[model samples]
Target: MKEINREVEAILRDMIEQRVRAMISGEATSNDLLGILLETNIRESQEGGIKNAMTTEDVIDECKLFYIAGHETTTVSLTWALILLSMHPEWQERAREEVLNLFGASKPDYDGLSQLKIVTMIMHEVMRLYPPVNFTERSAAAEVKLGEVTYPPGVHFLLPHIFLHRNPETWGPNANEFNPERFAQGVAKASVHGAFLPFSGGPRVCIGQNFAMLEAKLCLARILQHFRFELSPAYAHAPYTLVTMQPQFGAQIIIRRC
Candidate 1:
């Protein structure tokens, strides 16, 4: 684990340096995505950090997080949403209709996205089924007690979201099924407390949750406006969790111009 962490850190550091050089030389065309994040990290590091004074290493770490947290998770969410939408044409039509009604010929903006309740429900449902971070671990820093179990300090606990999300007791009989209507009114009205946490919960909740949702909604709306899609016969429904929950095989879909 230590070696893997080191390797990951080194790779991100190199990427950051390369991007910085590109920006400095005016070789980069845009600073919209990673270039912006890299620049922000550099500026913060130069500003002598925040309250705690972040070191160069800390800035590098933040850059790594900005990449993983900002990009990878949203990519998985979007892929799964597209796969589900393709598999269910009725739902796709409904979502596309909602997007069209809300935005029409205009591009989606922050205010327009806020009115996309159906798209929001669909995204939430996708997260429930294919949460990007499938599992997480927490180590007890001190002795702790739950309903029935007591753990000593230094004990590690694993929470597998895949199982938890599909638990019948919490989500009812249709737990394993694809039913966005379940979240039509939003998660607060859909499930028990702590039952649905695709982005985890509490103070440690994902920082980029809002950004990811907006990105997914915008991308889906754009795709729907340009194309109609359906699951290709070649698509296999096998999903696995490596670093994230992804279809073991590529998601194959049939697309026709709209």
Candidate 2:
């Protein structure tokens, strides 16, 4: 792990150096996240001196975080969405019909995507069944008490959202089943409050939650516009967690152009 991290840092460092040189030479202006971060750091240094600006190491750390946290989570979520949709052709047809009605074969737009009620429900249902981050952790800042138990400061708690999302008490007997209709009224009314957190709740919830949903919606919509798909006989049903929940044997599906 350390060796891999070192390699990644080396590549990021090289990229950052090139961008910094370009900015310094006035060769180009960047508006992307990296460029914006570097520009902000430069502005800070100019205004408050180097002492107040993010160091090169700090910038590298931010870049590494964006690369890891922003990439795999969404990729796996899309994978699961495709797998589930293929397994349920009725839902797949419903989603595809909605997509066709909204935008036909043209590229999906922000307004059209937002108006995708069926697609939105499908994505929400997918996340509920196969949440990318199955669990999240938190540490007690001070002593705390539950209904009957008390915990001391510094204690850690691992909250498994997958079980919560599937609990019969909150989601009824069909909790384990895939049903996008549950989300027809939206996530808040999908089940009991706090029971449907594909993105963990509270102030520190995943920052990429909205971005991830938007990205999945757009991609899924576009795919539906161009193809019809079904699960392959070679596909397996194993879901395991590495960094996030993923199909153990990979998602294999047969696709035909529309």
Candidate 3:
């Protein structure tokens, strides 16, 4: 296990080094996040000033963060949304109907995607029920007080996304059920007390929230445009968590061309 960990770490380091060097030396041109970050670092270093840009190490750290926080979480959320949609054909049909009405068997434009009301509702509900990360942690810098509970200084707090999202008190009676209608009004008004925290909330919210949303929307749109999916007979209804919550068995969904 230790050897495997060291091997993985070395591979990550090598990849980061090669990527950064490519951007710095003008050997690779990509429009992806890594390329943009590398470009920024290179430009800033040339312009001169520590305050102007992140260091190489800082850029590498951002790359690592992007891998851990951006890629897996985004993919997991998308997978969960698809699985949920497959299980609930009513929602799937409605989403597909919405997709067809706007895009109509053609490529979905960004403008049209932004107007997908039903799709947005379905996405939000899925996020609420199956947030990519099950839990997150934060340590108090100082004593904090909110309502009846007071947390002492340096106290580590665990915020369980699954519990908060599914609790009856937080989201009312149907919290455990899959109902996208709850978010029909909008996210800000979905939970009056602000219990919804899929990508988390506040200043330290997920950095790639917008990116993930856009990607998921586009992916869902494309899939619905030509395919209707449902759970296959072989599919087991077991969900478990590793780093991110995923199907304990693989998601075995049947796809039919629309």
Best by TM-score: 2
Report the lDDT of model 3 for residue 252.
Answer: 86
Q: Which structure is stronger by TM-score: 1 or 3?
A: 3
- If scored against the real structure, what TM-score would every candidate get? 0.83, 0.95, 0.87
Model 2: which ten-residue window has the lowest total lDDT? 191-200
- For residues 91-179, could you state the per-residue lDDT of candidate 2 as single tens digits? 99999999999998899999888899999999999999999989988899999997899999999999898999899889899999999
lDDT of 3 at 239: 72
TM-score of 1: 0.83
- The collision pairs in model 1 are none
Count the clashes in each prediction.
Answer: 0, 0, 0
User: How do the residues 101-169 of candidate 1 rate in per-residue lDDT, one tens digit apiece?
Assistant: 988868888898889888899999999989999988899999999889999999999898878889999
Sort order, TM-score high to low:
2, 3, 1
Segments in model 1 whose C-alpha atoms lie over 4 Å from true places:
1-52
Model 3 lDDT per residue over 1-258, tens place: 799757766776687678876766768567877777767777787798667877656766676688889888888888888899988999999999999999998999889989999988988998899988888889999999869999999999889988988989878888889999999999988876778888888898888888888888999999999998998889887778898888889888888998
| Ranked by lDDT, top first | 2, 3, 1
Error of 1 at 241 (Å): 0.4
Model 1 CA lDDT for position 240: 84
Q: Please state the error at residue 181 of candidate 2 in Å.
A: 0.4
lDDT of 1 at 48: 62
